[model samples]
Target: MIPRSRTVSLLVLGAICLAACSSEEQPVQKLRPLALKEQASNIVKSADGYAVTWAGVLSNANPWHFGEHVVATIVGHDAKGAEVVRMDQPLDAVPPGGSLAFTGQASATQKPAKVTIQYRPAQWRQAARIASAFQRFPTSRVQTMRQKDGAFLITGYVDNPYSVPASTLVVNALLRDKAGKLLGGGSTFVDEVQAGSPPRFILTVSGLPKGAEVAKTEITARTWGSTGRPYEDLALSGAVPVHTIKPTSEPFAVDRNTQIVSEYKQ
Candidate 1:
């Protein structure tokens, strides 16, 4: 038989142990589903095979959530519903409250009757809201010049307003006709931009449809964290020190008239 005091001490120790075990068990957090808008935009025949282009936007529903290692799979199917080709594309990261534009290509030996796209998120976590905190650089002296070879050249300067260096500056240009119909699109990536400096970028888009003249052009600029390991880039290094680059829109005519259509707030 145990003494009253000893029995009470044993019971107290057991209760403390149980509490400790409960505290160590953290509940799994279920991330919100990612929204994807994708399609097979263009298909062309090549000597070796047929090339298919897939383009779309991937959005994160949670305003305070961010994800990494997101992958997109493109599957081409034949008339009999048989898989012809499969390609996987990797997206580094998705900003909170904003969407990422992706373009992927796949080559098939035979012509595919239909194509399908799917997105998979490797990991999701609650992240600090920083999508709106990016400082947008001012774009100036935009020009669209037609090359001798028929390719279009879109040139512009981007100024970084943040104190730290920004990496992975991506510039996208969409060429449209007089009726606002998209003719073709091109994108270029800049390695890095120093603080308080403007960098000039030249993007060339080839293979425009025959007799397809570009009447209107739209340009957008965006930047992301370093392509290195996670958190290596200053933008994703920390919540307080990181800054985002807001999206900017500039519309211009192929004849050289430029105007600001709209600006996305950071």
Candidate 2:
């Protein structure tokens, strides 16, 4: 038999080796932050009062999680460089390798000449591995009608191709002039969409520059699982069913200029 001290030393060495192997198998994860960028095309105007329209892109740079509770602050400055209005808005979740396009508007009595935007990220957690479970079906029969009041009305249909229901179906439309200059944009939201159901959407935009006509129109649609809880909770509660399937296509980026009819030329 070996000496007692030698046996104790060997046991201690074995214990240390076991601990090192355990740590290697289950490594601690470092927190990854979200990245955001404000689009230069964010529109700010002084209508009857101080009207501000803001838009930005939020990207999830994480490798395996979603960014939730993202907040944005919009500060408006008057011609004299005084703060006119400040407002904070919350954006939707951004999944891994995906980005969210967010828009918000605020109105005050003071007119603003310039506007600034800032973003604040709250939490980064593992997202449901089923990003492909939610999808936007093919939009059908898009029609554009120009009203006498210089407002364009775009009507279309959106379908939910997923087997599970989707919440908060948002449709966004961007209007650009012949030179590819963005004129104005608008978005509409739907509360819920049943599986395999096609819902109709109507988006309208007004106040275009005089003699500016829509040369190109870009439309996109997205759907979320639920906004009430966190993504992790949703996944655990079966709110967002996870699947091994992959997304068939990227988000919609359909362009249609044939349906656009303008009364004036730019």
Q: Name the best candidate (by lDDT).
A: 1
TM-score top scorer: 2
Lowest summed lDDT across 10 adjacent residues in model 1 is found at 257-266
State the weakest 10-residue window (summed lDDT) of model 2: 225-234
State the lDDT of candidate 1 residue by residue for 66-101, as single tens digits: 666788888888899999888888775665666666
Q: Which RMSD does model 1 reach against the true structure? A: 12.4
lDDT of each: 0.66, 0.64
- CA deviation > 4 Å runs, candidate 1: 1-30, 38-40, 135-153, 174-184, 205-218, 223-266
Candidate 2 global CA lDDT score: 0.64
In candidate 1, position 5 carries an lDDT of 100
